[model samples]
Target: MVTLNLVIPCFNEQEVLPETTRRLLTLLDGLVANGAVDASSGIMYVDDGSHDCTWALIEAFHSRDPRVHGIKLSRNHGHQNALLAGLLSVEGDVLISLDADLQDDLAAIPRMMAEFRNGAEIVFGVRHRRDSDSFFKRVSARSYYRLLRRFGVNVLQDHADFRLMSRRVIEELRGFREVNLFLRGIVPLLGFRTAIVKYDRHARFAGESKYPLVKMIMLASDGVASFSTKPLQWSAYVGGVLALASLSFGIWALSIRLLTDRTVPGWASTVIPMYFLGGLQLLFLGVIGGYIAKIYAETKQRPRFIIERTL
Candidate 1:
């Protein structure tokens, strides 16, 4: 039987850690008992510089059960980096990543393992439905995935970071050294034989969501900018279209002055086009600037995360 490791990233998850620990250990026990995974299988928790007793609770779990492991980052490096840290650090034949909250159903674990045994190297735990989410969240999330697809990002819809990767897949993933990580996009690019196990998402067991609206927007921006230059290309296309429109307007104005009896209002015509073109210029510049910022970040080659301690 292959050793299975669950890599969960935590930030201020003190409220849910106890129950999360209990449920996961029980699940692992069941897997081991059924011979689905080796008895040596375990869980690794990455503490993303949470200020609460999150690390201490992890230590407590580790003391009580050798199956529990912990990796504390030097600082909060966001969820994607923290998850990456755990995946790279853990030792197992297969690795499954999920959130600290119980939102990602544990029930899908066995189904994913079955898929893996059936020759799937990457088993994505896709949400079957988002009935637990608010209406705005459901709409926005659907739109976000659709937007990524439009920008040519090959991502599995309703699949977040909750998925299984074989050792070879994780090893290949390590070769990707970009500092601005959007794993949701990067994983799909790995081109492995993949499978999907659908499960209903539950509400957060406890604590506030780590991803607020602002962070979600930033993640979407990163997903778009990292995978495709479509935004930058669109900016150029817009500029070209505007230029043609401006030339056509100039010709129309000149013709009115020369051949037509109707007089064009000089200030209104000039100022309106000027304002419109100016706004478009600023908008495209902002898009270009976003790409430049990503370039600047990638050049520094800073370590994505630092492990302050591990247990």
Candidate 2:
């Protein structure tokens, strides 16, 4: 039988965790009884240093059930790192990484396992639709996927951190030593025989979203910076355009003075280009500085996360 383990990363999810646990345990029990998975198949919740009763609840569940396990980080190390901590700590035939809010449908788990049994090394739990999200979010998400692809980050559209991977695939993933971890982009690079399972994303059961707008922006920034260098290339393109424009303008002014013996004089003409060029220079500088900051971070070689406790 395929031994399955679910790795859930959570932050401040005390309100919805009990219901999440009850539903997952019931589903796991059914999967075991139906011979779809080994009886040893279980679920693990990685506590991302939530300042709440989240850890206490996980500990309570772990004491009552061997299937329920918990990994506590020293502090909130972000969702991706917490997911990695859970995934790297386990040794199951197949490891499924998901969120504790249960937004990614649990019903899709069985379908993912079926795909795995059929020889897929990786299975993505992709959203069939995002009707529940705000219209802005929906549009932005679609655009983000396309932009990533344009920049050569082969990511599955509408897929978040919900996915399944075989033991070998997970083992291979361990070789990724970069400090900035964008799992969606990194996993596809493994070049495994992958499959996608579509499901409708559910609304969060309770509590505020762990990923707010600020965090979402940071994720997109990291995704672009980590996977592609197109931003740097675009900077070069902008510089070339600005240089050509300056040369053309210089020639135009010089020709006017030589041919007509008159000068074009306007504060608007002078101040406008100054502001525009200044803004562009600052923008490109920020992009270059971003890359330098990332290099400095990687060179330091700090631990991605620290484990405070485990169960």
Per lDDT, the best of the predicted structures is: 1
Off by over 4 Å in 2: none
Q: For residues 1-311, could you state the per-residue lDDT of candidate 1 as single tens digits?
A: 89999999999999999999999999999999999999999999999999999999999999999999999999999999999999999999999999999999999999999999999999999998888889999999999999999999998999999999999999999999999999999998998899999999998999999999999999999999999999988899989999999999999989988998888865988898999999999999999999999999999999999999999
Q: What is the lDDT of candidate 2?
A: 0.92
The residue pairs found clashing in candidate 1 are: none
Per-residue lDDT of model 2, residues 1-311, tens digit only: 98999999989999999999999999999899889999998888999989999999999999999999999999999999999999999878999998888798999999998999899999999999889999999998889999998998888999999999999999999999899889989999999799999999999988889888889989998999999999999999999999899889889988998999688887887789889999999999999999999999999999998999988
Candidate 1's C-alpha runs over 4 A off are: none
**TM-score result, candidate 1:** 0.98
Assess candidate 1 and give its lDDT.
Answer: 0.95
Please report, in order, the local distance difference test score of every candidate based on alpha carbons: 0.95, 0.92
